[model samples]
Target: MVPSAIVTLAVLPLTPNGKLDRNALPAPELASTSGYAAPRGQTETILASIFADVLGLDRVGIHDDFFAIGGHSLLATQVVARAQQELNVQLALRALFEASTVAGLAARLNSSTEIKVSPLLPASRQQPLPLSHGQERLWFVEQLGLSNGGYNVSAAVRLTGKLDVDALSAALSEVVRRHESLRTRFAGRGDSAVQLIDPPWPVVLSPEAVATEDAARQRLVALMQQPFDLAQDRLLRVALLQLSPDMHVLALSIHHIVSDGWSMGVLVGEIETLYAAFCAGRPSPLPELPIQYADYAVWQRRWLEETALQRQLEYWTVQLAGAPGSIELATDRPRPAVPSFRGAVHRLTVDQACTA
Candidate 1:
């Protein structure tokens, strides 16, 4: 797919050894304001400010295209989140993607019919909180012993130039402190499962030095492949690998139980913001979250108990009435009752002539 915008740079940034330094390249600038339309009303004004803040621009106009000005799907979620938090309105992520400009999104907000969703507030921890429906299924799979490294979501980012290890550690700890799910552990209360929120604690980074890039890659892969114990171990893992005096790699892994693709984007964004502030000897600028994952878990259980549950079940039941239980496919071996979660990569080369 084509990129949303293309930027022209005078020269490519290069590493000390003269290779392209991808991370050092600048993001595409905000769209030109020659045709800018000033925000007209309160709603549009608020939305414009949110767009600018999320895009890291000084100001955004009502007619400016979000994607044309360096916005992406990950940043779109942040925009929607900020709008919800500021406007106290429920919004679908698709709404922002479809109506990309401030004026268009404000019109959408005006036309929406849904009631304001009750805010997610922190609940008392004295009583055990029930596992979210999604977490319950994962807990079941863990109990069945079918879970493995398959659920681990791992990512690595290369850091160039002087690195601050202490600031990085403090940033990570602050993130864990903000998002309770990263520090949560699950347990069984009779036949039902519950989540326990651990008090925020310091997170220590595992530092290691590697002689070669290949060795660093191997070590990162091994660390990512390590399995997490839902009942015992913390759901997050982070390691810093030093490849050279001027270069390092930060490897991060989180269990799917506590994170997903979207959440990972948010996590990285927070760390980036926090790390910079700490390095500058400034306090964290991130605002405290109104609610934590544990609060969402409690809110979800309460909402599911209402009449909405029956309506949703009936709708889905009708939609899938005639669907088959399983699809039959030829296989080298019979499928086991429990999946081992082992996987392998297979590569196939396609001929250029096939397209022409």
Candidate 2:
């Protein structure tokens, strides 16, 4: 198998002259991607090549999905632009969902199929209610940070057993109904922001499944590689992995807009509770959240504008002073004159003696 290359860049603070002052940035190491490879010769290949050119993917394949490869919503727009230029087809901003795979998307294009428009919530579900104070606050904070692109953050977990699809479905539904953030969407009000309420509950499960471990890994990898709708309010994704007859893993991802690490913990605890209850043949109702993510956004804006934030910024400036231009590393490709955060990961294990 051909080895894939990985890239990393140190982000620096800008000086008054507008040049990157690399000396002020932290030295982040380049991550590795030895086992991971992009799919080749599929519709994904065309898209991936475009993405690689724009985002600088060291290695990409046709079967590779965008999100699994660390593609975000900001990058999704870029992909759409490339598609328009290369394919000469008009794609809606949301086309990534129906035509996620290269083969899947290429088929759509070949057949001249129309892209379907999806609603914030499916019509079968109940309409969502208004946003709470907490949800409002979360939105404000995201806007302030200029990190309002992606709607969900996700992770993968391994599990053990033959998954009962019926039970898993019920548990997912319960989690969605219990959390308001899962159902909330943001509307732009002229120059301001508005939080539109909708019932966004219950996880949507894909019908596709693989029968073997290798096939399961390939499916999961492909799913992760594809980009999802992040500009929308609900940005959570979950995948179940059946590694063996008795071993399974769960991949949980949520958009940062509706959740933080703290909120994720809350979601996990609730999911566990609901899942256990379902397994026992009696599931209880989930208590309402004190507030939604939007409320936190509003609160964050107010907090950041206060004297406390001024002091915090001052501390950060001092703490990050005189760092370095960039972290030096051996790479598969020549370094770009300007650094970027094209990163990959490596796993390490230590022996007992090393631990000691």
Best by lDDT: 1
Distance from true position, residue 173, model 2, in Å?
A: 1.2
The numbered model that scores best in TM-score is: 1
lDDT of 2 at 196: 60
Q: Model 2, stretches more than 4 Å misplaced? A: 1-152, 204-228, 295-340, 344-356
Model 2: ten consecutive residues of lowest lDDT: 116-125
Q: Estimate, for each residue in 137-181, the C-alpha lDDT of model 2 and write its tens digit.
A: 555656554343333455555656666656777787877776656
Judge candidate 1 at residue 199 and give its lDDT.
87
Clashes of each: 0, 57
Error of 2 at 151 (Å): 8.2
Candidate 1 residues 215-294, lDDT tens each? Answer: 99999999898988887888888999999888999999998888998998999999999999999999999998888777
